[model samples]
Target: MNNIALSRWTMSYFVTSLAAFAIAQALMVLGYGFPQAAAAAPATLALVHIVALGWLSLLLCGALFQFVPVLTAHPLHSNSLPLPTLCCLIAGTLALVCGFLQLAGDIHTGPPCFVFAAVLLAAGFGLVLWNLGRTLWAARPLSVPARFVAAGLACLLAVLALGIVFALVLGGALTYGPALRLVHAGLAVHIAAGLGGWLTFTAMGVSYRLLAMFMLAPELDGRGTRLGLALGCGALAVAIVGGVAAIGMGVRTSRVLLIAGALALACLVFYGKDMVHLYRARKRRKIELNSKMAMLAQASLAAAVVLFLLSLALGRLGQLLPALVYLLAFGWLSGLGLAKLYKIVPFLTWLECYGPVLGKKPTPRVQDLVTEQGARKWFLLYFAAVWLGSAILLAGFAPLFRISAAAALFASGGIAFHLLRARLLLDVKPELRLPDGVRKPNILYSFSPKASLR
Candidate 1:
């Protein structure tokens, strides 16, 4: 197997994505976007897109660039792809945010701005899909991660196409008052595709491989993983098809959507059980801080699933919808990404700096490049604040909800600080190294049995 190293520029995704998260949190606390009273307000829409596209989407693209190659044993098609992808995303996101702000201000000019933003964002998505899709196409017989990622790219394509049409409607380029119903139905479908089909699917696929690598665990159960993927894809397809019917044919397929939701919940249960088995079968006795926090994130995902089903059953799904979004976005997606970043940034830094010097001199192990002790408290605080915020949002206590948002904002700040420090290799106390005579130093990120340290 060949060893593959990802682009150094992928770090751009880490820094910029976290910055966008901080901005979104601040907007929530300040009542600019994500206001408790007006869930569908323009500012709220802008904030959601920022988090979804600029933050989460960019982060996923960056990680996949690195890990896709790692999983497929094939290097990225182009190291240059990430830098341009970043440019397009940043520009498009800023334009979209501005358009939303204008709409919130009741400006007549908002529609045109939205159209322009749509064009830019579509271009960005086009580049990303082409790049990643090409890489996957070249590799024969995709791995599970590759399969999930390819599925995600497909969903992303659907998302962008729908978004462009949505933007056109808002821009008054399409005038069918009756067709506006389609927009409403499309909204829910869009969120489902973005969150469930794209983000959740990709995260699950990556975690299966990543957790095993980090924990020295047995490889994930192939049959179980494939089954979960199949279920999830089926669920997403039903939801998308039902949504299209509602939009194009003006048919409300609520029952179809409900079935999709049930299938999705089942998919989660399957993946969760597989994860538990993976943890139990691990060879490593000592679990790292990142993995510990990741388990919490996984728990949050499960909690979010339960909440969805309960809301649907009780006929209170609307009341609890925002809370579900909160749990999924911050608690599940952001939480896992943040926890993993603690390890990824440092490990990448170690590879770039210390890996070359291993035989020449005493060098730090991957674990020594970051201080887990310093980051654990922050992780705990972040999750606690997320839970509190989600509960407060569901309770319909406006002032209290804002307070919880503030707590989340502060906790996110702490996380950003720790991640930045790790990226910079600041305040890292090198652990004692083995002498040259004791053992041969392992190559970082290599697949060869002689090269792998873990």
Candidate 2:
């Protein structure tokens, strides 16, 4: 283990991200987004941003703040920056949501909110890129995981710049010819960059490292892994270039995007093969709950890919795209995140509250801080609801979709409660408690003033 210093604000990020996720699910249950309204409806846009910027982006940022050091054996440029970053992200997301509500005619606020949102989000993401980027750069010749993060950061910059343009255009601050054309045709490109390049690529990289660590499998740096990375990069490059070209030519769909999709699919195939190899080669005889839940998440990704191909073959790609996106966002990405947090929260809690007393006193194992048996049903329920909801949406049944969303929200709440239990050290046995002198950490933050593990 690297034994790096703890990230003081990571738990705060996790808490906020979970709250955002629950809010997004609540919106779904209330029929605020797709299937209830047009895919491009302002309410749907608000819901999407809540999931993207508020939930997944914040979660990823927190993970990276901790994970980058492990990958590079170096510290962040400055730990002080993350709290500020979190504040900016939260404030910006709220402003952006309100701006969208204004567009939906539910509020009367004007262009200033949009511009403020764009500025705040840019500042927040820019700080993240600077901190993590500098840490990776100092490591010199980077590992594959580090390379993935670097590429993802590049994609994030592109997404941020495009988002700024989008916000300005929506706020009527940009009426120039090119900006207007991009406003009309660039949404798909923005989605491709944000979801495909930034989120998926980063997730792929993080999962490669984390799965190996958790499974007791060898680190994979073979040709297959390399090829998968190359293909993913190629796909993103093609998508961005093709998207820009389409915007310039005043078109929406392009053969270039098709080529990009094909490359992305091939990348997924390689990634899937690597995952199979990891599982088959693992030394751990008994897989834990988190790994098991992660397998379901991987299965969700496979299902989404299969559905996409089928929809394309049946000439229903446009109609099915929203369902496919829902599967990716909720089933694959969010599912994987929730699964990992089930383990990570306890592990970090153990380190934060138990590490200093390890040699001097008895302590609980990390696993002692969580009850996998009690939590498993929630994981299962969450995935089931996500899959059922996607199917209902595909079948054009909005009411059933809302019901499924409610089920998912219930499952998510159950999962969050368990994570909170872990954070609070509620599951640790009385005999394994720290000695009288050692202070237990706060439920959602570290107790140490210096934020060092030792």
Candidate 3:
């Protein structure tokens, strides 16, 4: 597996994901050609799907394929699955995007596109979760983050199931009826499961390790760690399942559900605060760009929560809620996902190439795979674009929203390309490491001493 040239597949899929994002951006630019609130809905949805499914999911699949074995001290069930997963995701996303575009033009095509995309997405999601699941299941007594990821995969499955139902709605196969109470009631459940379940849980699971490693802090453990996990997992269940059930009962039940949602947000806040505090309390003073870029994402999420809660309190949800959702999905979720991938891709390349060669022969440090200084410029541009695009979103000009969407694609593409470029430039002598941008060493720190991964 180590000698299988996994780097090529990784780089290729990275390109595929970024290309989709760029195309989506270009489409928005051409579709609207002027900023307007009218295009915001489709535009935001397209952008969210592009970032989450195309860029982040592809990147994560590529990465975990390389590292899961290392983490578990076991070889993967099949080393070739990453390629197929990448292909399915890229193909599936394109179909869905086209379906969405056609549907937006007219209600007719929405259903077909939804079904097609759902099928493809399901295949891709299944491959990823299945592989990761098998690996983690075999590795016993997993660490907290590992357990979180194990749980996160469950949420991912729930999200995908709801997502299929959403597709059914688009396909005209279902409607709101007493018989199909599940469909109407399911939308709320879908959103909660998709938004709060898959996306948030997975991010938290990854962040628990990634943030600590980036900041040079120890991985969470003992009681404080247990509390964090318990709060996170418990709240996710309550808000998604319990809250959705409440909404099914009545309006009054719905309000109680909203409070449960509040508690979910509270869990997020504690998680965020703890991560920030961990970073600030770190022994390493010069934090890397990857870590710093994460702050912008965290800030976006913080603002999203505040705006959402404020809207809820002031009874202005109808007017302001869409904008808030946009901020959370694109600004917060997509942004952080992109920032981290810039580092993760190259690091994976390092492992696939140099991991086995470690200690036996002179080898490049993982940092040798990427240039930190180069990464800094792209992150700066990406964050700048995020703030600018978010501001345009707030102004409610639809054409401006389209433009912001374009900027986001360009910025995000730039970072992903930056990863490829970093890899190509790394043709240095063994042990002559290039400086990876603000590398937090702890993400992979849990490698068992007995493992041959290093």
Candidate 4:
């Protein structure tokens, strides 16, 4: 593992993802639902796909490109993977967006493009997972995050397989009645695997280590930490599986989901409490943007738990479930990921371009890339948007929901624009650069891409 962390490509991905997150939010405000384009509804099924595929997928792909190597004690299998991976991903994303347009414009009146786009997205994910798996397996003895990565990958495959099926239905390759039945039977599992498994599971795994790193807290590997992780993921598993069965099975299994959710709730309560304790015990006095943003995330999750418990007790879970999913995706998971990206991107960019110089004559302090105050402001704005947006949606007020979602769009856009430019500025700050610094030096260092930095 590199003594320091993060890479350039990853940094770029983080920048792009923040941009995508903002764009997706803006689209929500604009009322651009996938199948119901007329209503311009923010919560269209296509919107879900955008948050999942465009924002979360891009962010995670970037993270693994960098962090997975550190976690596994391995370099990329080849440097070649990043570009192709990016191409496949961006193209796949385009296809998926097109598919959404087709589905939304008119299911009966839609274009054939949707069918093509979905297949392209499946291809994109396949390439990403395949290369990522190779790198993870090459790491030898797997770390905890690697194990979580495996779970995430497994879920990605599951989600895609189901997505492929849904795509067929959309294309009319499969008849509607049977296709809808299959989707109804399998939709919960598909959603859970993608949302909880692929996204939330990996986030939890990363933060277990990262939160400790940023805060300089005692490492979270003691009995309490392990117990919390096990309980949380374990309980979640039971709830999801049972949740799936409850949908298709009789009322008995449905009853079991209540029990399972309660167990998961217990785990979440402990997990959140532990994180609070960790934050309180930190050696660093003033928290950075990452920590503050994460705290917001913790609060969001707490709200989600409250919603879940209320839903269960009121026997209105069927009605309340979609809102719950909305909170989890935007408020908790995506918020946390986006918050960390602000820190992670700048740090990684510094590492790849500047890390090797640390022990040499002179080097830049890691803090030089971005300031804390600016980041904190962005994070606060983002969280406020999430809270407001979730509340508006839950209230079932279309105009309010549209407005809040639009605010998120603007906030995220500003973050992406500012962060992207600042990263570039960091690379060429006159004070940060040595007098001899240039992209290339004399013949002695001829032809090496990084020769100038040395």
Candidate 5:
């Protein structure tokens, strides 16, 4: 832990990501996408990009900026890169959203926003890969978590390349027959690579380390972890290859995709089993609120897998795909991200403020910076709303889905407020604060001078 350098721009990434999440939720509550429009509708595309690019990608980038070093026991290749990377990502996301709106005939902006968006996104993701890839490369024979991250980075590159081509086709910059065919057939592969390959794979890798650390459990170094990683990578590879072949060569790849999906499910089974073992083997007897809430996220993943398998069996997979996506995006990914942030924000705050003064003076424990009782309800409300919303969406009830989305929005707001409170040290005792000379950390930046703390 001592070897891990602080990521100065990570909090900025987190704050921006949360803002994007709020906007996405607000859009849901307003019925901007999906149930209100076709799944392939422009408005739906805009909303999905807001969640996927603006929220989840940024969140994942922030976490990686901080933890990649922790995983490899090496410093980041460059600390100067994250701020510029964040800027590019934010600009790209906004441009992409506008491009979607332009396609929907909502905004009549000229200049082909999709092209700009794709360029900016490619540059941003390229920087991320360069920085993290070098760091991982410097430490050869990577650990299990690091290997997962490496695989995810490769997927991110694939996602970027596919996305850029899609953007070009949509923006009228690419009208060649092959390009058009790729667009028509590559959507599934693009989505699967981004969501499953990049986001979920990276999250799985980070959780393998973070959950263990938080639980005081042994880090997994066994066959199940290895198998899961291999299968996950294999699944993504198969999906990409099959999709491309179906598009360009006019090949039948349904069986290939089916095999990929089966492998994905198997990957999940192994991961779930490992998580169970992780929890059972924990050295810490008392679980904190973060770990407790993460259980719901794990359960959401399980529920999603079960529902997906059932829908496929019933030949209703297409009908239930949106619900499954909702479950994955909000219930599993967002839920886990928020659960981890509950602890991470406070822990980072503690480290920044009290680390230098430790042993020299009295300081609050990391737990003292937050009140779990206040936050627990918000986590419960969030997961409950997500579950209800997914079910309602599956039932094709738009109005009820919006209502549940409002509940989710409310709960997310509460959770964000709690995280903000932790960041500001607002919940810490005044007596504890006065003796330690602790001050509120910057809410949206991490570049404050160390001298200011003194």
Candidate 6:
């Protein structure tokens, strides 16, 4: 077995990101934003950024740091990058949040503040791109996960550039004839690129390797894997380019959007079929909770596509777009994130504590670190609320949306509790049996890997 060296700061990112997720959920439950009267309202914009930047982006970065080595069979270019990256991301995200609140009349601030915040965020993202780029380039032979990660990095760069331009326009720092138009139309592309191009693609890439590894299944079929990546990239390019062209030329790109949607659906179908194949071929008969819940996330992606097409067919895409966003953000992206974290946190804990002692003693398995059966309820509630909330939002029931949001809040809180417990090794006893019948207690503290300790 390969010993993957994980960064110590990875958990910091996880903790902070989960905290951001919880805060964002609390805000939604309290009706600070989301399900807004105007989807483009400042409050809605702020909330969206909170989830995107503060929650998902941070989580992605952390996972990358830990898994990049595992994917490439090489340690990170430097362990030092993660600390600065975390600092920049957290500070910049807070600034952006404040700037957004300023726009919402929740605070008073000049437009330049928004520009400043965006610049800070760009700096943060730049650091991460450079760090990961060096790491990926150092690999001997690129793997599928690396390809997906590289593509995701490219999308992140484009998204950051477009995001900075939009920020400048919002900040009154730069004004061009078509800038506002692009900003309006580009918002759709931005979401598509950020969520679909960057987040979804990267998650799929990571899960491809992780699912098989966790389940002791064979690697994904090469032909299907390549096809999925190609189609997924093509879909992103079409959506992004068409969206920009439509905005600049003031033309209807509905056909282009439809084509992109179709390509994305095809990509999902390929991915779904591949996942089903892996599950069927798994050597491990008992599926873990994380992998099980991840299936729901995949199902949610299919559901989102179905809902999006239905909206288009009904000519109510404008009204129903938020519903689509809700399903994608919460059910697909977040649902998968939470599910993975369930396993990741505990596995990392085990690695940190017992990796050195492996082959020398009998240690607790990664599965022994967390109470999966307990977390299963939270996972169930989270998805249920996402489904119910999305339906109510589409139905124009504001009150019911709030109620569903509160349920989501509870679910997220439950997940956070589990994560913390796992990290602290609260559920596991301190003693372990040796192969020769000796018992070692608390040796984990002395023998813990320095890389794990950071």
Q: By lDDT, rank the candidates, best first.
A: 5, 2, 6, 1, 4, 3
| lDDT for predicted candidate 6 compared with the true structure | 0.82
**Per-residue lDDT of 127-151 in model 5, one digit per residue for the tens?**
9999999999998889999999998
Comparing 1 and 4 by TM-score, which wins? 1
TM-score for each of the candidates: 0.92, 0.97, 0.81, 0.84, 0.97, 0.93
Question: Higher-TM-score candidate among 5 and 6?
Answer: 5
lDDT of 1: 0.78
Better of 3 and 5 by TM-score: 5
Residue 113 Cα positional deviation in candidate 2, in Å, after optimal superposition: 0.9
TM-score of 3: 0.81
Q: After superposing candidate 4 on the true structure, give the runs of residues whose Cα lies further than 4 Å from its correct spot.
A: 1-8, 34-43, 106-114, 175-180, 232-260, 426-429, 433-435, 438-454
When 2 and 3 are scored with lDDT, the better candidate is 2
lDDT at position 160, candidate 1? 85
Q: Which tens-of-lDDT digit does each residue in 1-454 have in candidate 2?
A: 4457788898889999999999999988898887788999999999999999999999999999988887777777788999999999999999889889888889975557788899899999989999998999998788888788888898998899899999988876778999888878888889889999899889889888888877889988999899999999999988987788877887765687899999999999999999899888889879989999999999999999999999989999889999999999999999999999998888888877877777788887878999999999999999999999999989998878899999999999999999999988788887776666567777556665333332
Task: Give per-residue CA lDDT, model 3, range 222-257, as digits (tens).
Answer: 565567667767766775667556655643335545
So what's the TM-score on candidate 5? 0.97
Candidate 4, residues 95-180, lDDT tens digits: the string is 66666666555434545655775667677777778777898887767765566676677767767777877777766776766456
lDDT of candidate 6 over 267-328, digit per residue (tens): 88888888999899999999999999999998899899889888878999988988899899
List, residue by residue over 298-411, the lDDT tens digit for candidate 1.
999999989988998899998899899999999999999988887777666665555555678777677876777877888888899899988888887767766777787787
